[model samples]
Target chain A: MLQTLPTEAALADAPPKPILQLVGVRKTFGSFAAVENIDLDVREGEFLTIVGPSGSGKTTLLRMLAGMDTPSEGNITLHGELINDVPPNKRPTCLVFQSLALFPHKSVGENIAFPLKVKGVDAAARKARALELMRIVRLPESYHDKNVMKCSGGERQRVALARALAYDPEVLFFDEPLSAIDYKLKKTLEKELKDLHRETGKTFIYITHSLEEAMVMSDRIGVMRAGRLVQVGTPEEIYGAPVDRFVCEFVGEVNTIRVKRGPDGLWSGVDVPGSFKVAPPQDGAALDEAFVVVRPEFMRFLGPGESADNRLEGTVYNEYSLGSRIQYQVRVEAKGGEKVMLVELSRARALPPGADPHVTLGWDAADAFTLES
Target chain B: MAITHKRRDAAIWGWTLFVLVVVYLPIACGALASFNKSRYFGFPVKQYSTDWWGKTVDSIEIGMIVKTSISVALLVTVFSVVIATFGALAFARYDWKGRRLYQKLILLPIFFPQPVLGLAMLLGFNAVGIQTSWMTAVFAHMVWIVPVVTLVIAIQVYGFDPSLEEAAFDLGCSRLQVLREVTLPLLWPGIWSGMLFAFLLSWSNFPLSLYTTGADSTIPEWLYAKMVAGYTPMVPALGTMATLGAAALLLAGGLVGMLVRRRATA
Candidate 1:
């Protein structure tokens, strides 16, 4: 299991100096800002994934990092050397485009050997390095002579990876490289990429819209919204302790109950027909109005003689099987009309057949986090 | 229903065949006449002889005209392709102020009436005190052909995946290296076709060449002079040679393209 650490604490207990740092980076296209005031430190030999919905400026930030686009404001440093004006070709980093961008006219071997050729490597050494990289990417050596256009999409992706690796760059940037692949292949490649990262020990900065993909492969994940990096933490921290409602909802299935603090120093749901115990707000800030965020897996049906800090009565409206787990959407009546709460449990803990409609859902206050609405 | 469908197919084939015959019958007639021994272009050949074909090769005036036309056409092809390539790259890769206006201006010569363009170029060269020579004819040919070559190359550039070039740069290639190793290789088809078009267009050009050619005669101008003077078997023989030369050039280009593609994939 991955350890969850608050972003601040993690930075404070630094293991090593960051290999890349962006201080107050901003990119603007004309009058509109694409990315605004992004400051980040990317640790050496770590897999950092930046994830966001489309148009969230994640790609723009990545373009700046890859040196394809320059930041409009502030500076980016590689190992404390300013690289804001470095062109992509001059930088010690490479980007694997989402399109794979394999040279359709060239053989796989030639495509992979292109960077080596640029460095003036001799023909024999280039061929040897190309074959080695092909093996590292798990592509068969026999396929090297095949035209890249003749290869399948997954095979082409492997070829692109091999080509990028041939540069032997200090850092590698992947711009949604597997987004075009089929689901099964994507899953396989995701694991392979994680393994490749470990084996190479290079700083990898990847950008994707898939939180699941980021969660599976990243040592640290940065979640962007609009034009801001709203949260950056380990996968456990991001999933368990998102900083805002946007981060909370973006990362996974979540249920938020709107609540307000009363003069009695207790919290009560504004619409729900009950007073609710809740965790303190993040950073120990007292809040007059707050939201209680609860993941479906943390909320369960209360059996007889069972209790929790926060409890509610609701009826299951729908159930969905998610392979090993089952999710139930329970409808609770409140003054606002109706509220739906999602409850998830292991398949083995599913409700018995023909159970009564009425059921009590409960969760410990510690499992439910509070954030200022 | 089957009968009507068959009738429709027959109609299409008939129209296609008619078009082909209309386009090719004149060339076929010229080729056949080139082999006829009769000096007069008659329906029936009085005799079959290789004299006219041999005479066409042996004639000093015809030889000079052919040499001048080939060199001028080659120059026009090279100049037009180079200029068009840069123009097409700019059009494909960048967005700048007045881009649409620039595109229209570049393509203006292609649509201009040939006689008017020829007259205007002749007058402009005279005004600039430039002597009318083979170079002037080459320059006039380029005025029309460059726009066409640029249009063809621009179309190809538009279909290109730009990320391929980006990936090259990311892989540590300099700008020149990316162009040499990636862009030029991928754009070979467009360049080849553009060169062929420029060469053929300049080779057969008549109106512009007539005004700007001055004392130097190109193949088409010489053919016109010969026709105006009198009908001869050598005229058809020269025509046949030009046609065969164009076919051979096209075949050679295709062979080279095939070989390059094979090597690329290998």
Candidate 2:
């Protein structure tokens, strides 16, 4: 691993300050806004990732941050200095492209040494530093003289990282660099990248379409939708406490049902036919017309004697094995039509096929987040 | 199965030989005529002699024409490659307004009739007070060749990974530096092949050369001029050299392209 001067221990001893800030930055092309009203603060030595689906403006936001594209509105600052107008080369940051764009014509060492050469580093010194960077990226010293194109995809990625680190930028940006690699290599590189982030302790602003990737590697993940940053928090927070139905659906699989509050000091909606108890209304939530968000893991298959606050009687319409667990889609009759309720249970606890057509799905009110539709 | 595959392979080889004969029959006939022992265009051995070949080389007029052709070819290759390289880079790297218009305009010369281009060049140069000299000829050749160069290289440039340029930029390179260090190195093969196309086109060029060349002319212009006086046996010798030269140039062009593609994929 390549270790910069200020590392995890150094960060623990004295927390680093914010190194970069984007204040209400917006990028537009003609009438279409690619990124609108984006405000973000990147802490020094922290790895922050912005994740979203395709065309969600994650790349555009990262481009603006890297100085490749100028924001149409607002300012981008680096270390309290306005850098919105500064070009990419003038700024002290580097971006790694998705293609792992290693120079095909140059050798691995030459590619890694390109930054130093641009800064007028001598040939001998450049070579030495190139070797050091290769080592930092965990590339073998023998690869320094090898042509970049001769290396495999993962090796090329390491070279790209080594080259970016050669600049010794205050921050480094990754534009979905691992999206092109094979799955096995991608998994390994993700862990290596997380370790590299910790080792270097430089502010890393990465962008990806994979939320799982964002979860594993980032200190915080910002989710974007339709040119707007909907929510920004740790991966756990984004997964657990989504504010809107879109964010809830975007994060992962979830089972949702429309619910309405009745005069019995309880909430019952179209998804529930008879009287049902609902959790106390969330803060600022409407008294009626709310959707209950239940994660697959939260909806457990109930036993005969066991029960939960919210329960639905449904049949196991479909079932599939998921490693140690089995997921069943239970169909139940609600207000207007039949509703499919997802139920997940340990394989050991699940009833055999055809043995349990009628099953009850249950979850605590706390596990079911009620969001205004 | 092995015997069947061998028969099929032999059939393929026979077909390939037939195609080669179809293509090269005329060139082979002309080449044989160059060494004809007879005093006219025939292949029978009347008296095998290298007299016509020697005469073809030693003639001052023909030598001047060869020199002119070589000069124009070299100049056209250099200028076409240079202009087309920068043009291809612009077309490839940046997304700007009028890019489509620029591309359409660059392709205008390819579809334009050669006589019309020649007349256009002649009129344009005359209007601008430039005479129909070798310089004008070279200029006219470029007018035709630039489009070809641009078209060939643009495909190559478009096929290139833009991420390569982004990578260069991230490594602290400016736009020009990226073009020079990354873009040009990758694009060199396309430019070289484009140059070959431009060179061969200008070398054997007749229509534009006729309109624009001066009194001392290119090889094709000289040969056309010779035909006006009377039929001459030396024409086949000159044709032989030309056929071989064109084959060599085209072969070199193909080899360069193959090498470049190999490098790129490597």
Candidate 3:
């Protein structure tokens, strides 16, 4: 085993070369920069998502990559060739817009086969390929002749997907196409999109503000704030290890206890009892002052004789039933003031109704991570 | 409360009918005069005959006037629709500096009195040593009609999704291809309505054509001249034909509009 280590290490070291690369790209309108300098490598055949709130430059970045807008600074390369100034029509890329943008005047087949038709393909071949794409997208064969406007919202989404695939682009860009979809259908489409990415082996760059949506489909997630990229990681890394308070709170419900190291070499919390046990910060920053970030599900309710690294008592102000699990909103009275924290539990382990409002919430030092302010 | 609603509804319908009759009374009178046996129009016809209608239909002079009116209307419609389609897109779709000022300036012509506008144009043409004819009348009509048609098309342009054109461009269509394939088809309904307005306004116009068409006369101009020259039974017969022609064109335009909408959404 020791003799084979070099060969195995060589095999494990192989990484996919990027199909598209951006370096120090910035876009501005007049004096206002819509997207700041950015560096990213989109691996070949991977699903990458950019997630941020409105005006966070997610759309601006997607537009630049899609060839709809040019970067004011730096270079965008496709397959090691500069394509920074190529217009969208000449670029081997396609964008599925936020509105889906189906041609209201065309039938489903015409809409799907538009790019093929633009290539001057014969009518029969265009129709044949459109039908094949429709099958790939799982749209019914009968919908080929139906007007696009007559289709339901979910059907329209399938048509848009088929149209984008018809172009046979090297990379596909999606600008929040599922944002307008209803909840139940959005969930189904998210899974179907992930499966489609696997089947096609084509690069997909998707943008949305919903982190949950990004987590379901992306191989890598890039979190954007203001006009800059805050962090880039896999879904597990983004959820487990955020960079700062913005990204930490953005992930979801969490219990944050701000703490400062004392002269005696012990960490003391400012929000609660000032005795929090925290792991070192992930970024390797000085940990003199930091926040202990623990997800709600990692929190435990300490009963009589139960033990944990740190414990805090708080009043249960509200309880929410989240299907198989439940969450409690607790208000902890601390040295500074009262701070709200969320604790979750499975249904079988739920706290009983009419119980005492005050309870102890506990967690191990290993279950929580620390972040520098 | 039910009785009050019934009474109010009756009053509304009564007012509507009264207004309709008052508006259409001149056309009805003209129709009656066309069939009257007497040479001059008189209330309560003693007899009815098709003699005036036969004479008006066979007259070459009247035919020339009708042809002239149609040619001017067609020319005006074509020019106005082309100009207004671009105008509407710029007004409501594209974002540019001073767009608000451009919109306000484009609509200013619609507020001017038509006769005064006509007189000013006639004087300008005369000062330039340009002779007036039916061709000049077409231009005169277009000056007013293009702005009105632009306003009509802008309402539809305001609702158009700009992303549709962008999507087409992204899907491998060139700029001109995107315009021909997506932009024109989406704006077709508005263009059709603008065509109807341009044609009808040019067809029935009197003041502008009166000043501009000096050597070449249209139906309205000819009718006014004949009425001032002397009364003839053919005048009312010709007026009745003009009214019927306009009504038929309007009905045909409405049917075409309905069919186009159905096919688009079908």
DockQ of each: 0.72, 0.56, 0.87
Candidate 2, after superposition: displacement of residue A74 in Å? 1.2
B143-182 per-residue lDDT for model 2 (tens digits): 8889889888988888789878876776788888887888
* Rank order (by TM-score, best first): 3, 1, 2
> For model 2, how does the per-residue alpha-carbon lDDT over A127-181 read when each residue is reduced to its tens digit?
9999988888889999887878889889999998999999999899999999888
Off by over 4 Å in 3: A1-12, A280-285
Worst 10 residues of 2 chain A by lDDT: A1-10
Stretches of candidate 1 exceeding 4 Å from the true structure? A3-14, A280-285, A352-354
Locate the minimum summed-lDDT window of 10 residues in model 1 chain B: B257-266
Interface root-mean-square deviation (Å) of every model: 1.5, 2.4, 0.7
TM-score of chain B of 1: 0.95
Ranking by lDDT: 1, 3, 2
In terms of DockQ, the best-performing candidate is: 3
Put down candidate 1 lDDT per residue, A1-373, tens digits, no spaces: 5554235467668677899999999999999999999999999888999999999999899889889899999999999999999999889999999888888888899999999999999999999999999999989989878888889888888898888899989999999998888999999999999999999999999999999999989989999998899999888889988888899999999988788877677777788877767665452246788887889999999999999988999999899999999999999988858999999999999998789878999999888888778
| CA RMSD of all predictions | 2.1, 3.9, 3.3
Candidate 1 TM-score over all chains jointly: 0.95
Show model 2 residue runs off by greater than 4 Å.
A1-16, A274-288, A352-354, B1-19, B252-266
The alpha-carbon lDDT assigned to residue A88 of candidate 3 equals: 93
With a 3 Å backbone cut-off (N, CA, C), the pairs that clash in candidate 3 are: A268-A274, A269-A274
